[model samples]
Target: MLLTLLWTLQGWVYLAVVFDLYSRRVVGWHMDRKMETSLISRALMMAINLRKPPPGLMHHSDRGSQYASNQYQAMLKQHDLVCSMSRKGNCWDNSSTERFFSSLKREWLTGNLYSTRESAIADVRAYIAYYNARRLHTTLGDMTPIEFEKIA
Candidate 1:
């Protein structure tokens, strides 16, 4: 998903986030002034480095141009990740990512605008930390992602 920041000196900063479904955690993210294929690729690389899932791991996303690009597809193949795209016009297929974006805006970025891309990055970094380590999730039986992982 893309998080757009307006009113910055550089015009717009876009954030690409990769959410892990098992623990509902944001395993990877990248922010830049442009929404390019490299942005998504970088985010996926972060997740791959962090989790290092086994071969044939399933990666699902909407049919965004960035995800559909040849470069992005090549990266997936290199990592032995199988790609799964949501059916056209179906939002429910990626509800976990959608919910994360909703919570990010409502709980972390509501009514506030960052003056710089650096500040936005800091804010998002802090929120992801809190969301993973402190915030309770009903889906995880009211435990945080880190906590659930520890016990699982």
Candidate 2:
């Protein structure tokens, strides 16, 4: 999923994120001034490097051009991941990731004015840590994502 942030100086910053569906943890993410294939590709690379998921792991995404680019598709093929795209005009297929972005903006970014992109990036990075390590999820038996992963 992608998120947009506005700072006082810069017009907009874009964030690309990859979430672990099982644990609801943010496995990979990247922020940039421009939304491009490279942005999402870097995020995917981070997830691939960190998790090293087995072959045939499903890679689900929206019908964004970035996700559909040749480079991105090649990466998925190289990793042996099965690609899955949501139906056109359907957001529900990616609701879990959408919910995460909603929580991020509502819980952490609301009423905050960032002076620089760097500051916003730092704040988002912190929120990711808290989301995985501290925020409780009722779906996970009132445990944080990290705790849920540990137990599972």
Candidate 3:
């Protein structure tokens, strides 16, 4: 399952887990509040537009109504992406996504609070950019997500 983490302030910022199946790189992401269809929809659209993952990619997420919603399922169907839903009350199946959230909270969220959502949004946006571009991942051989993707 993906974590739709929001930076609480004037406008919320979201960090999507456009997590890859091979390198586990985050290919697409967006920052937004509302947590409505648009937030995740935008993330998925960006990931598809940019990565063009050769179709039939598997997209997994928890049973949040957002992920299981009709609109989400329809979009996946249109994209020919496989939708894998975690079982009820079970988070183990989505440990990777969960771990990402844990790291985010431990490293960032716990450090500060934003008076406005916009401030939070900005901070989270920078964090995600660094994460995908510069942060090294031991799992990916000390390569950033973008780096690993390039090497692959």
Candidate 4:
């Protein structure tokens, strides 16, 4: 998942993407007010409600404060999900996340104007649905994320 580090830019939206470990499918995502515990929590909730991963599933992310918060960790524990965090300040540990954000910015953010956070939230919801269900991934043999999962 990503909390777009656009603090210097115009928007104040927090974006999160949930990628499957095996297929690299972005199974879930959301845009919200801030990079709070709730933001990541909602993203996890979407992934849980969608994929329904087995217990003790592992979720990896960068060592951002949003992911490191006690509330977030507690939620992960509740779901029996193991927490894996990247080392501080290192980008490669979460390179896939970086790539996802780059694609989102290049493919969507640059082409759209969301004057309000609510607008961005709504658009992100639709975009992520398309990303998971329709957008073909070259890495997944040109299959959409959900399709790749089905085949796998």
Per-candidate TM-scores read: 0.93, 0.96, 0.85, 0.87
Estimate candidate 2's alpha-carbon lDDT, on a 0 to 1 scale. Answer: 0.88
Off by over 4 Å in 3: 5-15
Clashes of each: 0, 0, 8, 0
The better candidate by TM-score, 1 or 4, is 1
| Number of the top TM-score candidate | 2
Kindly report the root-mean-square deviation of model 1 from the true structure over all alpha carbons: 1.6
Clashing pairs in 4: none
Q: How high a TM-score does candidate 1 get?
A: 0.93
TM-score of 4: 0.87
Q: Name the runs in model 2 displaced over 4 angstroms.
A: 1-8
Tell me the tens digit of each residue's lDDT in model 3 across 1-152. Answer: 37566655455555555666566556666666666666677778888887786677788877877787899889889999998888899868887767666766778678687887777767766776777788888998998878888878
Give candidate 4 misplaced runs (Cα > 4 Å). 5-11
Compared with the true structure, what per-residue lDDT tens digits does model 1 show for residues 1-152?
A: 43344345546777788888888888898888888998888889899999998999999988989899999999999999999998999989888777777788789888777788788778878988999899999999999999998988
Candidate 1 ranges beyond 4 A from true positions: 1-10
Query: If both were scored by lDDT, which would come out higher, candidate 2 or candidate 4?
Result: 2
lDDT accuracy of residue 145 in candidate 4: 76
Residue-level lDDT tens digits of model 4 in 56-126: 89899888888889999998899888999887777887887788778777786676766777777777677
| Shift in Å, residue 96, candidate 2 | 0.7
Q: Check candidate 1 and list the clashing pairs.
A: none
